[model samples]
Target chain A: MSSNKQNEIALAAVKLFEQKGYRATSVQDIADAVGLQKGSLYHYIASKEDLLMQIAHQAILQFNEQLEEILAKEDTARGKLEQMIRTHLIMSIDNLETTTVLWREAFSLGEGPQEVIQGMTDKYLNLVADILRSGTETGEFNVTHPRITALAILGACNWVYRWYHPSGTLTAEEIADIFSKLFLDGLLAH
Target chain B: MSSNKQNEIALAAVKLFEQKGYRATSVQDIADAVGLQKGSLYHYIASKEDLLMQIAHQAILQFNEQLEEILAKEDTARGKLEQMIRTHLIMSIDNLETTTVLWREAFSLGEGPQEVIQGMTDKYLNLVADILRSGTETGEFNVTHPRITALAILGACNWVYRWYHPSGTLTAEEIADIFSKLFLDGLLAH
Candidate 1:
């Protein structure tokens, strides 16, 4: 199969998986969406799990690249963390469907694939924790559990996909700005 | 059906729903888990959606009671928001299985049930927004979008079920304390 055909199948899989869910969306559904028979589709992709793995890998590739670049900087921990949040929000907004599929169906993947996806997630987690720790070292952040706090921040970002509307009042940039400020300054008026 | 039997079915339904998901879980699975035949299970509940509606109502009842009490108090907006965070964390921790089901599967519910759940969620959101608004009015908080900020905080709490472990070092109380403080003091150390 040409790389273009593979990309076509993968995009269809992401849309079907997001709409009907992972279990409910069969290989046939993906094949139909791509205007091919199931047999022909199999020639382009290995299996349903393989489709999911492909989509997941595509999403993770972007995530790893952005985070890797962000971490390479010698900026303060707070600066790195702010950039991390900004990157995360941008990625989630740009790839809303892919992000939804990865967040919702990644857990249902087979152990090997689950571990692969999880390994990517853990890298993000650890990067956040590292920033929190540096903040403590530099007296920029005070926290009892750097790890849990990191999880909370990521959670807030992931949960946005559930309610974010494209035509909503707040643009993605505005939403990201509000999130960073709310998280950084909190709700304190004084 | 007796209330005890209904509760038993609801409990079994929640567990099965969490493990197999709402769409994948069959009525037979829930019945078998509750030690009843499928025919007998229908006598106790209207449908699978009914089972979910029951569970959601239970969760919402507790949520409303706590938020109502907290909102009625003359406490500062910051204090009320903290209490809301604490109650939310405690509820999510104590009702882990139910919370997981509610967060993950509640959207699959029928229009009537979905509206019901959304109504309760909106109440919580409005209450949080009100607190944030009060903070602004009293010169106690700074926010560009109080409603969005409220959603972010709740998202953080709701997403906890994905990663929170019972064996984790931080107990629910400690986690609540840390969360309340983190949202208030933020990551900045200065």
Candidate 2:
């Protein structure tokens, strides 16, 4: 299969898996949804698990790239933290399908897939933890446990994919600013 | 069937549903898991939707009761806000199973059940919004958009069930206190 055809299969698979769930969704379901025969799907992807694993890999890659870009920028710990939060929020909103797949499919992935996703998730999570540590050192952030706080913060941002509607009232930038302000400066006017 | 028996059925159903998900889980699955024959399962509930609806109602009812108790407390907006945050977090953590079902099984509830869940959700959401609004009015808190701020804040708290393990380090009270501080006072130190 062509690369574009493979992407089309993966994209359709992600949407269906997200909508109907991974176990409930069948290859025929994906193939029918994509206007391809069930056998034709095999030409593009090895199996259903392969399709999900690929989508998950793509999601991790996208998140890693986003994180790397933010960290590479010339900025203080505070700036980097805010940028990380903002970029995560925007990417989640923009890539709702992939974001949903990443979260919703975690339990479905077997040991091999779980390890890959878990590694990516830990890397992403630790990146936040490092920033929190730096903030604490710099006297910019105050929290009891940097590791747990980072998870809570990222959990807050990542779960937005479940409810965030692109056409909803709040824009992506608005959410980013609010979250950054909430996470960093908080609700106080001081 | 007796109310006790019905609740037994629902309880068993919740376990099955949570394990295999609502879509993949059937009345038969619940029956077999509970050691009831397939035909005997319907003696308590009308359909799978009915089973899910009851679970949703039970979950939301507890939350509403919790909110009512918090609202009844005589305190300033700041105190109420803090109490609300604590109560919400404790409630989410305490009722992990039902709460998880409340989120994951919403899609399986169909339209009528979805509306019911949505109404309960909106009421709970608006309760937070009201606290934020009162806080802003009394100058106890400062935020640009109280409604969206409420969403972001609640989103952060509500998704805790996805990751929090009771056997883990932080107690529910500690988690609530940490969340309140992170959201209200933020990460910035004086």
Candidate 3:
């Protein structure tokens, strides 16, 4: 199988899955999008679920790679948190279709793939929590519950996908700055 | 048509919709859940989409009513914001199944009902933004871009449905308090 053809098929799948939903989108629709016959499409992938898992896995890998780079930085926890939010926003907006499909369709996968995605999500949550815990210990942050706080911060960041658009007034960087300020300094005037 | 039976049918639909995606669930499945014949189920709802609209409408109505009560109070913006978070948390957790269905499946409705839910959602976002704007004007809150801030705050709150559980260590009120504090005060040590 040509890797180029596989990549093209994967991209087409994400587009259809995001717009029509994973269940509503059919394998033939994806094949049509990529200018391939339904039978020929199988040359690159086993089934629709296989294509979905590939896209979902790729999304998570990209997220984890970016997060790992941010974690490797020797900045303070606050700084690293800001970087995490910035990276998340940039990636989410840039890959909006893929992100949408991953969030919306990953659960529809079989148990093994679902568990794989869920496990990656758990690790992502824990890494955020670890940052909060370190900040608290270093007296840089005053969080009472690191895990819950992490969830709130990430939730705020993730929800950007529902509204962010390329033509929107605020760029990803601007939104990231706003979120970082909101999380780090809060709404209080003090 | 018996309102009691209608209510039972609606409740069962919410449960099934939450467990199974709206597309995958059949009218027959909903009827089976409520011990009603498929033909009889049509007596209560015009179609599966109609049932979804009813549930989604009720969810938005409950949210709006709670928010109105909170807004009617003459509390300070800080106090009201805290109350808003608390009210949202409690209501969301209490109606977990309904909320799950609303968030996940409401968009699958036909354009008309989808518009209705979207309109209500826009109004809700505007109301939250209004509070932030007033708070900023009153010099009680230091928010910049109230609309964006509102989205972030609500996003954090709404994402609670993804992870929250009755068996979790923290109750809804405790989680609400934590979120309120996080939103109102910076994570950085004062």
| Best model number under DockQ | 3
| DockQ-best of 1 and 3 | 3
Clashing pairs in 2: none
Q: For each candidate, what TM-score against the reference?
A: 0.95, 0.94, 0.98
Residue-wise C-alpha lDDT for candidate 3, range B1-190, written one tens digit per residue: 9999999999999988887778888999998998889998998899999999999999988888889999998999999899899999898989999988887678688889999998998898889999999999999999889988999998898878777888999999999999998998979998
lDDT tens string, model 1, A1-190? 6899898989998998888788889888988888999998878888899889889877987887898899998887778888888888889988899998888777668889989888988887887888888888888888668888888888888888788889888887888888888778777865
Pairwise DockQ winner, candidates 2 and 3: 3
- Deviating ranges (above 4 Å) for candidate 3: none
A18-45: candidate 2 lDDT, tens digit per residue: 8877878999999998899888878888
- Quote model 2's iRMS: 1.7
Better of 1 and 2 by DockQ: 1
Better of 1 and 2 by lDDT: 1
lDDT of 2 at A54: 89
Runs of candidate 2 with Cα error greater than 4 angstroms are none
Error of 3 at A25 (Å): 1.0
TM-score of chain B of 2: 0.95
